[model samples]
Target: MELFARSEKTRVVEEIGGVARLGELVRELGGRRVLLVTDPGIVAAGHVERGEAALRAAGLVVERFADVHENPTTADVARGLAVARDFGPDLLVGFGGGSPIDVAKGVNFRVSCGGEMSDYRGRATATASLLPLVAVPTTAGTGTEVQSFALIADAATHQKMACGDPSAAPKIALLDAELTLTLPPFVTACTGLDAIGHAVESAVTKPRTTVSAHYARAAFEVLAANFPRVVDVPTDLAARAGMLRGAALAGLAIEHSMLGAAHSLANPLTVRHALPHGQAVGTMLPYVVRFNATLEPATRQTYAALARSGGFADAHAPDEQATEALATVLIRFLRLAGLPVDLKPLGLDERALRALAGEAAEQWTAQFNPTPVDPSAFERLLNSAS
Candidate 1:
């Protein structure tokens, strides 16, 4: 048997009113000058004010940088770097969805290490340790709070870059379901599906191990049970908590394992069409599940196991039958979320599929997909979706 080592170094605070405890965490991290990273949407939604009030009540000096936008890019990081440099903060607070948190991570790297975002594009590229950071997520997706990766896109090329290092992981993840209660129905659906995609893809990626599988399976179970309820009843706090924690578990899985072709396909759609990341990935997952199952017996069985865990398939069913069941469940979520399952609804046609395939082949996550995926393979997958 092969040997594997797993590490989860971040402290997690899971409770209903966890954000109110930020003062205690700030003092523990020994933070003096603090910078809160967020966006206009979160500011308007009042989450940013609540977080700012918590830090202030802790008797800490606070500065707010609300310049971040969705799908943060090189320019956004540079803008954030300027603020961090001027403020000279010892601590950074990421207080929004994935975009703000990712920008916070990217800015930390540049402000501490002194380089462009692309300098640390791949894994472990940072030369020095980043500042102590805390994540206060307002959504239940991306799991960037727990993961050591910072996904920032290039401003010019619009290609998403994966910047990762051990130092990039948050020192603390503050999960408060109260912050997610205000999420609009569409946002809830998009982010929930993104979490589900992370769990589904991480389970069968090439780097998956025993530990990663444990997190992935647990995430799948929670998401399958609660994602629909939260989407249908936005005020369900219990269901919201389940989705939030499930996203974090799936994120931990990605930290240990990584993702697959669904993410690879989703990125190009986001870059080209400005589609939400969750919707893009969710649209492709059902097809990717079936695609990998046909070619990889191990992945087929893994999908089967996931189906059995969700109680949607018999434990003794054939790999193909189990995989089909899992795919059906994924489609059921997509449909319930009112997301399109095919490329045609997105205004793309058969003629455009080849271009999208070529772009997907260039994504870094594509290399980790269980079945070997070339542009030709992606062409077929896209066709299947159509």
Candidate 2:
């Protein structure tokens, strides 16, 4: 076995009605002046107002930055940093989905450390101390609240950049399913699949460790078991809570083990076709799984275990059989959730596919996949997805 460094740390402050407790937590953190990073959609959904009320109720000063986009760009981060600096916030609050949380992480790094985003492009690049951050997720996907990395897009090129550092991790993550009840069924379905993708990608990455595998497997089980249930019964609180927990666990797993080609490919699809991240990634995952399973029998077995643990059929089957069965299950799930199943269906043509595959092959995450992936393999995968 290879000796490796492990930095394990996560603090999730969870409750059935976390919104009601937000005021107390803010007061305890001694955050008199705070920067709240979010999007307009969240404001429209009333999450922003609710969070604002809670913070103000705690006798804290709040400055809002709600201009974040879906695939947050460098400009978005810059704008957010300006807000943070102008407000001189002692603490930061990330409210909403992954984009807002990711934006907040970027703001923390740039404001406190003073550097270009590209300077901290790779993993663990933070050399400066950062202010405390609290994350409140309104959606159940991306698990960005628990991660030390932020995925920000380049403003001009629209290319996603993965910036990571231990200092970027939030001090507290508040998980409350009540906030997710307003999510549309399709958004719920898409984000749930994103959680599944994170778990699967983590399980088979080259640096996969025992701890990452444990979290990834557990996340997969929860996502697989609860995703369809939530899609079928969107108001089921128990199922929503399960999906939220799964997303958080998946985030933790990816924070340690990183991810694989599915995300690598999915990023370009979002940049090129303007498809939602989760929908694009969900479409590419089945093909990536089948491709990876061809070279890694043990990985396939692990996936089989995940499927069985989630109560999916064919768990006891042979590795190849189980892999295929899992693929089928995923396809069915996507269909049931009303998501696109192929690149063509998502308005991606062969010309776009060729370009996207080439770009995906160059992504940093591709280097960490358990099985080697080249441009030719990526082209083949794209074709299969189409």
Candidate 3:
């Protein structure tokens, strides 16, 4: 049976002093022993300290797990599990970008479900109850805060595993623009682009529904308008809040609609070339948009609608021309963010492209792409991007 389950129950707290409300959330969730999962980078940025302080101020016992790294592997989850086991936490706090949030979910999965990460690589596989989680994002990307999916790679093979379960969704998403104000310019650009990619891809994916499209459209408009401002003026609280809210909405869209080829293509680049996830997706998005719009009428219309939301498409233009205009606009955002527009700049050659294309074809998200993509088709797409 086909299912269309949307996570509208994840309470979102969006305000300038939103992190201050964490104390109330902790009390309401009845959390006595809490586990805070984060990375060293977030700790250095002082966001982790602020989060810990919030929990401590709530008079809750807090345990810290700061061993998570970028593109977290299963080993990272095991490390977190070790801490969780010792802490016996009733609530888990994911305190950073996608990596820490995903790591927190991974640890919770094993702690509650009693298995290795490989046991739950696909969707709706978990039968065990998951611990309540609160997501505090310091970066305005990855929408992991609002989605139930966790991207944990294999420690040995570096192949990413997308684990999803209805129970894995965060119980609350705390969006405080103040936390994002300290983001470096490069991170702001990369994460902002990642949010935009999520909105764009989710709008045209196979599972897109009317509700999902609404969230995606709102995400696209807000991110498109405020991304440059947030990147250029990091201290602009309004722009930062717009990006944070937009990213959360994109995440909600992903929960309902899932993602498509860009994410599938981006994963291989991150695993093979150690490219940043946002950078990989952002660079390849324009090409993917063009590829899908050319081959699918529904996707072309969706792209045209998204372009109209951003004021980039002509209402009277042909679908192909409108979609092309959308792609051109995406390319402009990538260039403005100081990201490469092609794979060659990342030191990838034609030989490497063939291997990456094969991996991209096998990725689970590729099946959800509007247009079917085989290894040969991926090669063509890669060649175009090159």
Tell me which of candidates 1 and 2 scores higher on lDDT: 1
Please name the candidate that would achieve the greatest lDDT relative to the true structure: 1
- What is the model-wide C-alpha lDDT for candidate 2? 0.85
Question: Model 1 over residues 273-374: C-alpha lDDT tens digits?
Answer: 788899999999999999999999999999999999998899888878989999999999988988876877776776678889999999889999999999
Give lDDT: candidate 1, residue 79.
Answer: 94
Pairs in clash, predicted candidate 3: none
When summed lDDT is taken over every stretch of 10 residues in candidate 2, the lowest stretch is: 1-10
In the range 1-386, model 2's lDDT, one tens digit per residue, is: 11111344447876767887777787777778889999999999988888899888888899999999987889999999888878899899999999999999999889988988877787788878887889999888898888888989888877678898887888788888988999998899889989999998999899988888888988888888888899999999989888888899899888879889998898888777787888877888899989998888877887777667666655457767777777888888889898778877666677877898899999888999888998888999998977
Instruction: Work out the TM-score per prediction.
Output: 0.96, 0.94, 0.95
Q: Is candidate 1 or candidate 3 better by TM-score?
A: 1
- Model 3 misplaced stretches (Cα beyond 4 Å): 1-7
Model 3 TM: 0.95
Global lDDT for candidate 1? Answer: 0.90
lDDT of 3 at 157: 84
Worst lDDT 10-window in candidate 3: 1-10
Residue 13, model 1: Cα distance from true site in angstroms = 1.0
